[model samples]
Target: MRKIDLLFAEYGESHQNPTNKFIHWICVPLIFWFILGFISLIPSAHVAVLYYGLISVVSIAAIAVVSLYYLKLS
Candidate 1:
């Protein structure tokens, strides 16, 4: 199996119980959306200028770093 699929299969083993699985399905996305919305409310401060040259601010930079980390893991 592919690496991502194998990883998911192993992770899925823990949530095999129906109640726990149901809780995760319901809560996880809600929690993610809430957190994203909370972060969006933060007032951004100027952080840096890109080499090619767009101005970067704190909130956008934070999201970019997180996105890059996930990309690296994948």
Candidate 2:
């Protein structure tokens, strides 16, 4: 099996129970959003020359790191 398929199959194994599936379906996205919002509470810094570079925004950094992790997994 491909890496993505294997990853998804492993994920499926964990969610086999109905109650576990229900809770994960409801809570997982909420938890992800909550973490993003929590990190966004921190202030961002301006990069004078770039005009659009709001650097040091913790939420964006967190998302970037998460994306990298997903990439590695895939």
Candidate 3:
């Protein structure tokens, strides 16, 4: 978990560059949406589509804000 967190921190640092940040802003949510959509195809997870959708939106928003904040700081 610690390693994963460190990796993400490094990734966030790289994304402070405007081009990389823009790419991430677009790709991240799309990747997450596809992931959730794939998971929702599972029988058990299908029932929780709304929950997953909300979480995905919130996560994307949070990431966007954080990325922008870091970009501004850098």
Please give the RMSD to the true structure for each candidate, in Å: 7.2, 5.1, 9.1
The per-residue C-alpha lDDT of model 3 at residue 67 equals 80
Q: What is the Å distance of residue 52 in model 3 from its true position?
A: 12
Q: Which stretches of candidate 3 lie over 4 Å from their true place?
A: 1-5, 45-74
Each candidate structure's TM-score, on Cα atoms with residue i matched to residue i, is: 0.50, 0.62, 0.48
- Give Cα distance to truth, residue 40, candidate 1, Å: 1.3
Give the clashing pairs for model 2: none
Off by over 4 Å in 2: 1-12, 46-56
- Sort by lDDT, best first: what order? 2, 1, 3
lDDT of 2 by residue, 1-74 (tens): 89788889999888899999899989999999988877767877523437654544566679899999989986
Query: Across residues 1-74, which tens digit of lDDT does each residue of candidate 1 receive?
Result: 88887888888898899999899999998986677667756776544556644333645766788799789877
List of clashing residue pairs for candidate 1: none
C-alpha lDDT score of every prediction, in listed order: 0.73, 0.80, 0.65
Using TM-score as the measure, the top candidate is: 2
Clashes of each: 0, 0, 0
